[model samples]
Structures are given as structure tokens and as C-alpha cells.
Target chain A: MSNRDRIEVLFWGIGGQGLVLASIILAEAVGVYEGKNVVQSQAYTAIVRGGTSKANVIVSEEKEILFPQVLSPDILVAFSQEAYNANKGKLKPDTKIIYDSDMVKIEDNVPFKLYGIPFFKIAREELGIPFAGNVVALGAFSAVTGIVKLSSLERALLSKVREEYHEINRKALERGFELAEKLN
Target chain B: MSKNVRLMQGNEALVEAAIMAGVRFFAGYPITPSSEIAEGFSKKLPRVGGKFIQMEDEIASMAATIGASIAGVKSVTATSGPGFSLKQENLGFGIMAEVPCLVVNVQRMGPSTGRPTKPSQGDIMQTRWGTHGDHPIVVLYPTTVPEVFKYTIEAINISERLRTPVIFLMDETLGHMREKVLLPEPDEIKVVNRKFPKVGKEDYLPYKPADDDVPVIAPFGKGYRYHITGLHHNYKGYPTTQPEEVEELTKRLLRKVERVLDDIFILNTYMYDDAEYVLYAYGITARIAKEAVNILREEGLKIGLLNPITIWPFHEDKIEGLLGGKKKVFVVELNSGQMKGEIERIYPRKDVIGINKLNAELINPYEIADHVREGLR
Candidate 1:
């Protein structure tokens, strides 16, 4: 991508599903680790969990990230059917939609490029850590979009989480990368 | 460039800067968008040998901050719109008493609890005229996360140097947005501490003006004991109803800031040398304006930006010089034409256009670029 180009990503899901954490990891990877300018913002309900939560992460190679909110995101990662439904109107013809195959269902006639991954199923059944689904999604996003390196994401994740949880999260991320590779 | 770059939110930057500036006391009540400052200080202050108190309410928080400042500690209090209103009386007291302290208002939508989480520049005018008296105040608004960190230190320095209350105004957008900031090393940052009375205790006058029109304040518990009250006071700090004493005190308070306006006034200009259309903004709105200016510049339009880093004690001279030959000026804000009035007053000949957004939403870059396109056509 050109230095002037910016990639905008949106993570939408229930408040308990770790969408905010996913956005933070992505932003830190690109901004802190990769030395690119990034702006991350979120909108969530007042309640702690179960309400709609949305996080916007904009990564730009420019000297500044001028606008904090993403009006027309280039990539959308929806972890639930409610999130996908709520954000359908924001999609353009060239927008890329990444959804949880186990939770979100898209109509067949949609024009956007869609990638569905069973992040929840892999985290719970294979990894035995349901909370690791967000990391899995992050890995898939990095692999599919090439917006950030999977290695950088893992490093950012390890820096943010506790030492004891690092091994499981690393496995979850690798599982996601493998799943994305299979899809391609 | 200190390679210690970290992703920090605006609120977190404020706390970190305040602590670095020797802010040893923080008294605040939790309020949305501004609560992070309190929370961060709660965890970090004790480790740094500072104190953080969750006051019963905004009023108490303001009072406690002033009390701490009087005791010679660098103090701060953070709140949003409703809490800001509650702190106004004490804020005015701090002004009258010449207590050096920082008051951060992370502004959200409001008349009365309008939208706790949404961004707004509604407090732009309120921070200036909120208190019910004719007193001088310093208000600084930062447009970016790094600016937030830098300006917080500037706010504390100005408050200490001028012996007055400083308002660090931020909006919900900047308060919540996270960005990469190069954290400055301790020796790399310049810190200013309030000057203590140099004279013998027997000859010290608490309100006596020095060469800079600011009195050297002695901490309350110090040996140079003096009285302080919200009432107009004489040079010795005794309450006085005499017209001459009150007028002299008020004029000195105003003159201290006014005379040094050139030093305190801060603003940034972009592509303004040959521009015909100048956009004036601050806080998050200015960030969008910067992007809009870049887009318009690419499209071969002579558009530029003038963002006020210091919102109060208006940068009249700099703005007048910057808009010398500009034909039209656009004032973009998240309020209903608040700062636009100031622009109109300063540049009456120019057609000052106001692009206002008050719907609890941010004014996007596209909206501004489109507005400029339509206006040009």
C-alpha cells in the first residue's frame, strides 16, 4: 500500500466477545510494533456485557491519523448475526466482510467480498478456550488481508495479556492462520 | 525520538503528563469519557508517591484540588459537562484566590446529561464564562494524543507560572481515541514549579504583585501564614470591600494573563500562506479539518487550516495576521456556532461560514470536504 493509503477495520460483536481487545491488539501491532500511525476508537453500551460493542481501528502509513472514527470501513469483522445486520448499510460494493461462520449468516446476493470463519467453534472445541476466539479472528484477519503480520499480532497479544495465557493464545492464533490458509 | 513509543488514549496521556509535571494530588469524581483519568491516576499515583482521592462529588473534588494546591502540591481534577458545571463556583474561587491548579473538562454532549459518551465542543464557551465572575482563566485544547500529553504539561506550567486556574479542555473523541505516542524521558521534559515567597516571613504579602504581575504564593501550612477567601482581597490577603482595592486586584488578575498572551497563546497553521479559504477548528473537529484540507489540496483547492491549541484568551493577533487576505473562513465545530462568533468578531469583512454538527456525532472528513466543494462551486 502507498504511504498515503489508510486501511480502516471495524470489529463488531457483543460486549462480552472481546471485540475491543481485538481492535487494541490490531492497533498496537500496526502502530507500536510496525511503526505506522494508527487510531482506535470504540462505541459500546453502558452495560458491561451482552450489549452491542463496536471498535474502529484505522492504520495509516501517513504521519498522522487525522480522523479518529471510520465512516466507511474497508474491512468489517462481525462476530455475531446482530452485528452483521446492524452494519449492512455501511458496506460498499468493494468492502470486505469477515464474519463468524458459526454465529453470523449472510445473504447469498450480497456484493461485498465475504470470508466466513468458524472462530467460535475452533476456539471452544479445538483450543478449549472460548475467550481465545477473538485472537483466532485476529490471526485470520492478518492472514486474509495482509494489513498486519501474524507475528506482529502475536507479539502485541503477548505484550497485552498475562504470561500464563500466552501459550493458549499463540495456539489459537496459529489455528486461525491455518484456517485462513485453507480458505484460500 | 525516545524509542519508547506506546499506544495511549488521550485520558491516559493527561494523567501521565500530569504526574510527570509533579502533580502529586488528584481529586475527582468519576464521569464518563473523563473517568479514565481518575482511574489511571488511582492505580499510578500511589506508586509515584502521589495521592488520588475519589471525592464525593464534583464540587468536593474541585474544593479538594484547591485545598491541595494551597498546601503547595501540584493538584488536578477531571470531570465532564455536568460535573464541570458543579465545579464552576469552586473554579471561580480558585481564580479569585490565585490558586494554581489544573481542571480538566473532557467535554461530552450536554445541557444536563445530554449524552454521556458522545463528543461535543459545547463547553467551549462554558469554560470561559461558566463561573459567575469577571476573572481570568487559561484554557488549552489539544487536537491529537501527543498534543494531549504535551498540552497537559503546558497547562500545569501556565497555571503555576501565572498563579491561576488552567482549564485543560478535551472532548469525548480525543479522550477515548487511542494513538501511538513517543513517551518523553524525564530529563527531556521541561517542568515548571510555582515560585515561593523569597522575602522574610515578616515582610511577605500573599497578594502582592511581583514584576510579572503574579504574586509569589506561599503554601498555606508554610511559616508565611496568610488568609484566603473568595471575596476580593487586599495585598495582604484580607477581605476588602474598598472599590480601589477590588478594582486593582481584578485588573491585575486579568493583566497577568493578558500581558503575556503572546507567550501563552498557541496555534498551528497548515497550507495557509497562499490560501483563500481558511478553516478554523480545534479539538477533534480540527483533525477532520486537517484531513479535509489535505484532500482539497490534492484536488487543487487553495484551502488551509488554523487550529487553536489554546482556545481561551483568544489568539486574536495571530488569527488576524493569518486571515489577512483570505476571502472566506469556515469555522467547523461540534457545537452550534460557538467559536464562529469569535471568528466573525475578529474578521468581520470575511464571509465566515459555520459548519456545525450537534447531533452527538463526529463531523467526518468527507462532510467537511463536500461542504468546501459546495461552497467553492
Candidate 2:
């Protein structure tokens, strides 16, 4: 797992689910706060919402990030059933698959390590904000992978979101971290 | 002082650089992959006393940009594949009228309206000869986010200096990718403004040539009343049909850029000094080629990269020098052998292998590495 210096992460969900924003914050955490090289790119349908969307981010300790697209991602965070189904062919035997258990139901038995968290449920019931699911997924992913520090993620989120909405997101992130820690 | 390090996309960098380069007006239509430029300008331009207008379509946007430039304002417009096609007629008009403006084409996959979100380098030839007839234009391509910012300013500078419309060519990959960029301080960069006429109103020729064959552009309605048209024009900017007048104007227009090719052409070479194999690419493909060269070198292959920063007015001499003593040169691009055609013209006898990818996906580094290994074997 540590053979390569670069780490690729893919965030997949329907549009308007904040997957793109999550990818941007995650990239900012690693690239800006952690001072590593990063490239973040996204693909989505022409529709504004309820459309398949995916964001690919590559974080490298190397001086340069050559390819911006993630052909094979080390970590896949799925927020929708459609996203999981769409990316099933890209799954490798050792790849880590993280999905929202409340949103996606997996029928196929995959060889990779699969972890499910109720991201939407926690965001709505625990954090009182339904849109904070993306931040919760970020925290859970960080806790599971240990790729980027939670402090760095917090700082990146603070910088990205509006000043008025910082406290709610902070709570959402902390709840995510706690949930991931309990699961691990 | 603001911190120089900031996370920016290629489109954002272009807007920031244009603003810093004293661009006062932006007119553009929103299109996929390239729409961020218009969005960025809409917010940033107003703060700096500049104006941004989302025209009804690409044609109006290009015409309005030319109109702004004629009023002594540094103007810019951006678009993707189909919009670029719609813009070519007015782009040619800007060339003939010698209107200094910048046209940014963040290319997407297309012959017509191919792919809105996908990246392609298919517009290389379109930019060079898209408009009708014989005319000279400058086109700049940048591979990195930092180069996107730098070359955008360079595009504005060249346009103003040469009094010609400059095409700032970008791919959808670069346009959408986000990266960390250390923007230079405002005073750190060289900003060139257009040379306005200094003569009194009695002796002003709107189409008169300066020492470098580029005419000094005087803004319209500024007490310098002169005719400006797309037709063959004489020294006073009046329409001309005589053989000498038309011949001289055409020659001077082409000569202005041809004579200063050395000043405009920019290229970057990596590991070429002791390399046996060279990979020639531009834009996003060059970034991938750099990695491929690195991986092959670690495996002990003498591979190098020749990245063309200026795509138009092809760097023939520099490319020839880099190809010296190299056994094979792989021309890597996102289009089906667009740049490879130019390279073949330069080195007719050499083994110029073209690794072309046209499926709207980036050429991966592993693919390039494997090709190098195969070529060596």
C-alpha cells in the first residue's frame, strides 16, 4: 500500500449532494494546508441536480502531479447507489470502498474492504443539517485512511465555507470523526 | 500584503492575470469547461473598475471585445469548441483591422459540437488558420496552472505589441483542474500596454506602420478621426485596391509577426541534453510526458521532453536543435495527429512516432512509459 508516494481519491454522488465541494475541500486540505502537490477534477451530467457526478483527486508527495484524472483510485467514497454501480468496474481487489449505508445497498460481493457509514442520517439527525453529509464523509474518510490529518481538513473547510456557516460544519466534521473512530 | 500562494483553477488564473495585465473589458458567452472564465470575470472585473458582459452568443461576444479594444481598452473573450467556430469570422476582422485583443479558446472535443466537458487538442490547426485568407496571428499555449496565468498576460502583451488578435489556447483538462499556484506580486511581472499614436491630429494614419511594421493603434472617437475596415487599407486607413497598396499591407501584416518569431516563441526542454529519445507535446499532454520521461529515466532510459509553450508560429529551429542526435521523437497529443503533422513537416526523415489519443481522455503516464519501452525494444 505504501509502495507509491501518490494517493488518488474519488468522490462519487449525484449532483447537488456537495460531492464536488467535498472533493475541493479534501484537495485543499492535502494540497494547501499539508503542502503536498494535488490535482482535483470533476465530471458531471448537464443537469443541475439528481445527475451522476464524480470528482477525482490525486494527492502526491512527489514534486509534480502528472495526470489529473484518476484511472485507478486507492479510495472510493460513494454517496449514492448510482455512483457505486457506475464505478463497480473500476474496483480493484485491494481498493477501499467507503459508502453511505443509508443511501447505497450493495448486492454484489466484492473482494475489496468495504465500510459503510450513515452519512446522510448523521448529517440530518445529529448535525441538524442535511447538506453536511459531504463534510461527514470527509471526516470518516480521513479517520479511516489516515491520509490527511483531521486538523488540516478542519482548516480547509473553514477557509472554503462562508464565515456564518462554519460552526455547523465543524460539528458535522467532529461527528463524522467520532463515528469513524467508533467503527474502526 | 496578501499571500501569494493560492489554490486556483486554470480558468481562474487566466482571469486574474488578465486583470493584472490591465484588461479593462471582458465580453464572453458561457460554455462548458470555459464558462468559469466568464464567471470569474463577472465577479472580479467589476472590483477593478473593469466591465464584463455576457453577450447573447459567441459572435456578439467576439464583436463586442473587438469594439472595446478599439475604444482603447484591453479586452478579452473566452469560449470552447463550438463558440470558437462561431468566433472565427470576427476574429479575422480583428486581425485585418489590427485590433489588439485576446481570444481564449479552452478547447473541448469537436468537429462540430463534439463534447462539452471533454478535453481535446483538436483546435491547434483551427487556431492557426481558422479564419479565411492570409493573415498573421499569435497563439500561446500553457501546460501548467502557473503558465496559464503567465501566458495569459503574455497573450495580452503580444496582442498589444503586435496589434494583432492573440489566441490563448487551452485544453479542457487544464481549464477544469485545480492546483496550487504561487501568483507573482503585481510589480514583479512586466505589463505592456498598447502604443498609442503621439502625432498631432493633422498627421495621424491609423494604418501607418511603425519601425517593427506594427501600426500604432489610436483609439476611435478620440480626436483621431480615421477609417477602420476589414478591406485592404492604405496608410490613412482608407480602402485600397491598387496592387502596390494591397501587396504592401499584406506583407507588412505577416512580416510583423514573422520577423519577431524569436521573441514570441517559448519552449521548455527536459533531460534532452543527453537523451536518445524525445517526447514532444504541449498543453496537458506535456505534463503527462514529463512524468513519463521521469519514470523511463528512473528505469535507465535516456528519454526527454520538448514542450512547446507557443503553439503557433511553430518553433522550428528550437525543435530541430532538441531533436539532434535523438533516435526517435514521439509526438504526444490529445487529438488525432494534429501537432504530429507539424513535426513531420520539420523532420521529414526522422522517426516521428505519434501517440495520439482522441477519446476525450488524457493520455496516462503509464501509457507513455509503455510506449517508450516498446519503442526502445
Model 2 C-alpha lDDT per residue in residues B156-240, reported as the tens digit of each score: 9999999999999998889988988878888999999988789999888878898999898789878998999999999998999
Clashing pairs in 2: none
Per-residue lDDT of model 1, residues A78-134, tens digit only:
998987888889877878887899899999999888889989889999999988889
Regions of model 1 farther than 4 Å from truth: A1-4, B1-3
Error of 2 at B195 (Å): 1.2
Q: Which residue pairs come into collision in candidate 1?
A: none
Q: Note the Cα lDDT for every prediction shown.
A: 0.90, 0.88
Off by over 4 Å in 2: A1-3, A85-89, A92-94, A105-111, B375-377
Model 1 over residues B52-77: C-alpha lDDT tens digits? 99999999999999999999999999
Judging by TM-score against the true structure, name the best candidate: 1
